[model samples]
Target: MLKIQEIRELIKLIDKSSINEFKYENDGSKIVLKKNAGTAVSYQTEEVPVQPVVNQAPPAIESAPAAEPVKASPEVQQESKAAEEDSSLHKVVSPMVGTFYAASSPDDGPFVKPGDQVSKDSIVCIIEAMKLFNEIESEVNGEIVKVLVENGQLVEYGQPLFLVKAE
Candidate 1:
């Protein structure tokens, strides 16, 4: 088990570095910390095989140095709204932390793309971890609405790879 002071120190270190996520495991206890936008830090820990703890810090607000209100353009606002609407779709998530590949090989076409119909066993993408190529399957029958990640993007476990509209 990690002491509260030790966890605070680790959080400070992570805040000072460019690392967005960190994971530590020992003796069946595991801790995962992730940094997201808006200075919100989320953490999940499993102290025992059957018990888990999750914590999320309140979002922090920073005052603008110039005290000027910044506004997003209409196009940007529309895009953000679209993204929110797409959140209702089913997501095909990564099962492990790795580099995501859109195809089996460099020369091969992607396994699936936006608007492609996929069954429960369809291969959606490949993830390369520890020098092994792992084919990721879509466990839900649907039409792929969007490819969330680009080819060769680094993805964390449980990260959404593709959004699908269930049939």
Candidate 2:
């Protein structure tokens, strides 16, 4: 929210200057001061425009300055890493409709995890079609982002197996 004095100051500036518009931004909040060649000064934000109390004249109103782009933080990077370490890194998709399997046998461990680095042709998992198990290969070299299908789940041809961020 903009303070009343701040609004008045902006109006004063607009009144004195020849510039038709002026704006300032801080974090999410913004204040825009606008005036025509000869008109009343008005302030506006992303929400409602703040109309100045008309002691005498109507003020000019214009939109606030454009918002700056948000920057990614370290926490976002760590989260992305954790997601890559998770099973979502498998970039290879299913070539045919079948059931997804982690290993060749029931007693064996999973073929891959989130953090496991994979390359093109890496056997990430298995897709069983018509009682035949086919080894699924990784098509991209990258860290995993997410696993779309679970083990033993029925998978369709061309289904996404994992999301991978390229190295």
Candidate 3:
């Protein structure tokens, strides 16, 4: 079982992170933390078999009125066009859920950036999971065309980290 202090620390970490949900399992204990639509956060601790903390269902609320659809701005359109152009590019995706680091450390420069050339084995970024820093590599020889995630953002498994135009 996880001690209260450790659980509190985990909650605070999750609250400060961009990740919406985090699941941790140790021994026979499991902890699930999830953020709601607003600032509210819900968490639960259970054994091997996951169970709800409260058996009662929440009261239903009426749906809000539908709003008019807004048109996309010039920047949004340009980004959408760029995304379409990147379809042929090779995407470097995160192998695991973690915090993305553009550089090896705060004092160092990023391994690669947009328009930077990279070999198949070139390190592109770092992903920190469970206190372990994993150096992520570009598996294809290419020029980095775009970076998908921001530094210090939480990245999910298989989420695209960089887009490369293969040579």
Count of residue pairs whose backbone atoms collide, per candidate: 0, 12, 0
Q: Best by lDDT, which number?
A: 3
Give the alpha-carbon lDDT of every model.
Answer: 0.77, 0.70, 0.78
Candidate 1 or 3, higher TM-score?
A: 3
Error of 2 at 38 (Å): 96
Encode model 1's per-residue lDDT on 1-167: one tens digit a residue: 78789988998988888987787776656666677652343344454353322345675788656322234468755654475367568888899988889999999999999889999988999999889999999988989887767787788899777888888
Over 11-81, each residue of candidate 2 has an lDDT whose tens digit, in order, gives: 88778878777777765566656565445444455576556534445546888884442334677556645
Model 3 residue 95 lDDT score: 98
Give me the overall lDDT of model 3. Answer: 0.78
- TM-score of each predicted structure versus truth: 0.51, 0.45, 0.53
The regions of model 3 sitting more than 4 angstroms off are 1-81
| Model 2 misplaced stretches (Cα beyond 4 Å) | 1-90
The sequence of per-residue lDDT tens digits that candidate 3 reaches over residues 1-167 is 77789878887887788987777776655667765554333444453456544433455799877443234567755774587466798889999988889998899999998899999988999999989999999999989988776788788899877888998
- Superposed Cα deviation of residue 47, candidate 2 (Å): 95
How many Å off is the CA of 76 in candidate 2?
A: 19
Q: What's the true lDDT of residue 137 in model 2?
A: 81
Candidate closer to the true structure by TM-score (higher is better), 2 or 3 = 3
